[model samples]
Target: MKIGLYFGSFNPIHIGHLVIANHLAEYSDLDQIWFVVTPHNPFKKKNSLLDNYQRLEMVYLATKDYAKLKPSDIEFNLPQPNYTVNTLAYLQDKHPDHEFALIMGEDNLKSFHKWKNYQVILENHHIYVYPRITKNIEASQFDGHEKIHAIDAPIMELSSTFIRKAIKARKNVEPMLPKNVWEYLDEMNFYR
Candidate 1:
């Protein structure tokens, strides 16, 4: 099976996330898209993030109906400040029969080299990149551009960071998240 690992801190799962996962599963060779819930992202600030378990559960609720979409808690037991290369290597070792690939935005592609053990990841896995605001960096920026693939999907201008900020400000972000996810966040008092 071909699995595409979509890593994120899904503070609360949103429509943009579902759209991208659905698009990749429908249009690409991927058999499934797993939302790898990272405990903490090295590049991100901890103060802005919700609890990893909360975020993971929200992803579970949001993706319940899709067979091709899965919420992975594989990183829960991994070390904090999760690194993509380590996760990829761990998954490969654990699931030898399945082929795993990465699904990220063009923004991540631009900084792939700076990621921990990036060369190892590039050598072993295929990377699928969707268009993002930072995509204008051009392919020449990296020697491993060939390992990265661009997908044809509608670009979503939403990010979990932005959504969390909106919630903190009591701004209207009902449209930014899935209905039940918002309810769950409220029920759990996440991000408060």
Candidate 2:
């Protein structure tokens, strides 16, 4: 099966995430979109995130209704400060029968060249990029790249940071998240 790996911290899964994954699952060639919950993102501060299990549970709750979308903890057991290239290689070795691709936003694509061993990733796997509202355009190096595909997925401006801030401020962000996720957050009093 062709699986698109959508990696994220997912401090809390939200509707914007669901939309993008669902869009790619329905519109793209991918058989499934796995939400690879990163235990710790190198670009983010670990202190700001919830427990890894908590975040993964939220992901499971948010994606339960969708068959094509599934939550993954593939990076949880990997070494801290893990890079995408290593994960790709590991996944390939472990699941030789399945093909894995990447799902990222256009903003991420702008800095794709800076990732560790990005050329190796490009050579082996395809990347599906969704449009993001960013001021700077993508780098010219990616133009006409056969391995990269620009998907006409919805541009979601919603972010987990905004949701966290709102929840801490005691604002009603129920609509931004899935019902199960919202209930779990409310019950746990998370982000407050």
Candidate 3:
């Protein structure tokens, strides 16, 4: 099966996330998209993060209804300061039958070179990139354009950072996340 790995901290899995994943599954060759929840991203600030398990649960709640979208706890079992290369290697080893692909936004595309062992990742895996607000990937520049593909994923203009700020402001987050996720966040006083 062709599996697209949508890796993220998912501080809170919002509608924008679901919208993109759903759009990918509907319009692309991917059979499913796994939401790989990172307990801690090496490149991101960990001090502001919620508990890993709590973040995982929010992901679970956000994606529960979509059979094509699954919440993965792969990083929860791996060592700290999570690295994409390491996680990719580990998943590749464990799921040899399944062809894994990287699903990321164009913003990440610009910094792909700086990622740990990015050359290996580019050489080994296929990347399914999509456009973000400020970044648009030019596929022709990459050495492996055939491997690095882009898709037309609808934008919600909503971000985890934006949503977190909204929650902190005690503003309505209804438009930001799915109904269940919004309800859960309010109930748990998440980001409050």
**Candidate 3, 36-140: lDDT as tens digits:** 988887787788888988888888998889999999999898888878999999999999998889999888887888889988898899999888777454553
lDDT of model number 3: 0.87
Q: What is the TM-score of each candidate against the true structure?
A: 0.92, 0.97, 0.94
Residue-pair clashes per candidate, as listed? 0, 0, 0
Q: Between 2 and 3, whose TM-score is larger?
A: 2
Clashes of 2: 0
Q: Model 3 misses residue 86 by how many Å?
A: 0.9
lDDT of 1 by residue, 68-182 (tens): 9999999999887668888888898999999999998877777777888888988888988887765346663653578777898889888877887787888888787888898
Count clashing pairs, candidate 3: 0
Best-matching candidate per lDDT:
2
Which clashing pairs does model 1 show? none
Query: What are the runs in model 3 whose C-alpha is more than 4 Å off?
Result: 135-144
Local distance difference test, each candidate = 0.85, 0.95, 0.87
Q: Worst lDDT window (10 residues) for model 3?
A: 135-144
- Show the lowest summed lDDT stretch of 10 residues, model 2: 134-143
RMSD of 2: 0.9
Over 1-192, each residue of candidate 2 has an lDDT whose tens digit, in order, gives 999999999988999999999999999999999999999888878899999999999999999989999999999899988999999999999999999999999888888999999999999999999998887663657978999999999899999999999999999999999999999999999999
Return the candidate ranking by TM-score, descending.
2, 3, 1
Full ranking by lDDT: 2, 3, 1
